[model samples]
Target: MKKILMGVLCLSTLLCGCTKNKDIQIDDKKVGQVKLKFDHIVGAKKLVLNDGTYSNNSNETFNINILKYFVSNIKFTKTNGEVFTIPKEESFFLINASQSESLQPTLNIPEGEYQTLEFNLGVDSLTNTLPVEKRAGVLDVATNGMYWDWNSGYIHFKIEGTSAASPNASKSYKYHIGFFGGYETRTVNNNRVIKIDLTKAGISKVQENLSSDIHLMVDIGKVFDGPNSMSIATTPMVMHSGPHSDIADNYATMFTHDHTHNFQKIANNEK
Candidate 1:
């Protein structure tokens, strides 16, 4: 029957149970839009994983219950250097602090002026050695907790709370930070580089169309600064050697920014 009616029109173009393939036609340019942002914080305020705790300092309480992860390959770099990745079979991203609207998540890109941007907070090694099918938001896996139930993959970074310096041994200092190979872990790549120099990002115009708000800030004590140390009732684990993953790559280099987070931007609304 026409190959089962062309396999139901190619599975209805992937969205009705999504095998993905809704709209993809890059290297052709003309669909410009990028309002990508995901800002959540703790130190200077704004971060609420309520119910399972994690309120922002009215007196301080913490309990992330169980957060999700993943921020796959996404690159954009122009200004003659020329680069625009974003195809790890469609760059994944699943951040869930129990979905506080998932903190300003946005995406769309076409126009170009980029200087540099790179991503991969997790899920590398070709989609963690690929078998694929855990889908929803952020590559699904039944709603993106970035896997790793016992000894799998995925779990780049996930901070929890309720400390007095956690040490009944390990009830949840669960810093499941990953990358169990060289060239990409340990003294290799705790990675960092959001150095998006949009003319030093004071922003004047880079072929603008509209929505361009970029405010990224995340300095939760620099992800436990060094040796991933920030305790409570106790949960300490930093298993990335080479001087503790180069002090977690110097605490993600204390994320450089201009304003704050918890509102997220890059929603270039275009003209």
Candidate 2:
């Protein structure tokens, strides 16, 4: 009778421990949302569409009239080294400096402490070739001006402005960079993947009932001068067919993580 009672007690202790462990286990399947807030800036100054004049490293002052680009293929890395990628269909976003609504791209992802954020600076090649009907929302050609003909694909990045250094009679310059390795014929692929480490700036704590805002600064001046600095006076126009790899390389260095803000999702919804 003593041995039997001892065996029963052990079984009851093990059952209680199992129940306690299950109560404290984290649900990895829980999901949260994050908003990527992009602030357009000219070096140290905030960007003003048509009036603000900024100077690049090449010593050319210019006033921007238009600034737009595509950001897609967003992914987040957790503290445990797990990667959660947003669905491809909902990942494409067109960020236009002129539009306030397009500045922040919200993404729903698994709940965790994310240590890194990754995204493509331009639309991927596969999505670029999708049928016209399949491409909707920001990718819709009829609604957005970023699209070129079916043969040339979409224009990933476009900027237009006026500068005294420009040699044009009107002193205007335009840079439209895009070419996704071509559909049939091979071309220069300017699509670049940008990764931002969140540990130094601020790690994103994405949890249930909370929204994390990852603030990023995009310096427009970097477009003119990064790894390859170019003078506006020498080459004012960079279209689909030209040496634009330098421009692409320069713009790739434009994004920097500024900070992160965690807000109560319920409170935001209430307001």
Candidate 3:
């Protein structure tokens, strides 16, 4: 009878602990939302997917058919240097050029005055190590074809198009970049930072006037001629290629500051 009584007491203690944990989760503070818009363009004109012809710094002409990439580890830093990092598990995003909705979507953020926005241009190392079955959200390889099965890693960025320099009949060229271990990793840093002024958007405190949108531009011409220039005739494609650090690094820096708009000021939504 004593053993039965002890077992009942232990079970009650366990249930109590679980209830406390549940309450902690439910007590999380409410936050506001921010939007980020991406625009793809050439020197001074908007880019037309698969049809617009643009010349690179290297004087090579090309047209992009598909452009998809991943952005993760988004963090916002205030002028005072206080940083707010998005929850790692829920921060991964896959962006496709064909999808307008993907250009700018509202994302939840803690109430704060953010002056600088930063994010990774490719999948982070942690998500790169996980298998498809074990991943979730945008990192789920099953839903997104960003996974490379043969080499074992996510394709952080992909650019498929046709270049006049291509020797093939289709004049097709492709660049796929990622982390594949060993010397192939190429030691390239794919993180990008952008200066932002959220005051104009009326984002001053947690949940105060939270509707803010920032627009950014991605220049395709920069891809072939950033710090270095790429020739499609020499390197038209990279699927399983172990070393694509040059092209990856070039395209990673293509993002530039555009304009921000659609500022809707709502009262502090904090709970």
Best-fitting candidate, measured by lDDT?
A: 2
Model 1, residue 61: C-alpha shift (Å): 3.3
The alpha-carbon lDDT assigned to residue 199 of candidate 2 equals 95
Give per-residue CA lDDT, model 3, range 1-271, as digits (tens). 9999999999999999776121111111556667777888877778889788887766778888998888778888765677878888867788888888777655777655566778877776666766657688777776667877776678888888998889888899988877644234554543343344455543333343445566677887777877777888888887666447777767767886565443346445422
Q: Mind giving the per-residue lDDT tens digits that candidate 1 earns over 1-271? A: 9999999988786656754222322343554445445666655665555444443322334555554556667776765676768656667766676675654444455554555556656556555555656443465454445555454555566655454345634444555566634334432444333444444543311222334344556555455543444444332555443244544464455444453222123333423
Error of 2 at 157 (Å): 0.6
TM-scores for candidates 1 onward, in order: 0.29, 0.87, 0.76
- Candidate ranking under lDDT, highest first, comes to 2, 3, 1
Per-model tally of clashing residue pairs: 30, 0, 1
Instruction: Summing lDDT over every window of 10 consecutive residues in candidate 3, give the lowest-scoring window.
Output: 20-29
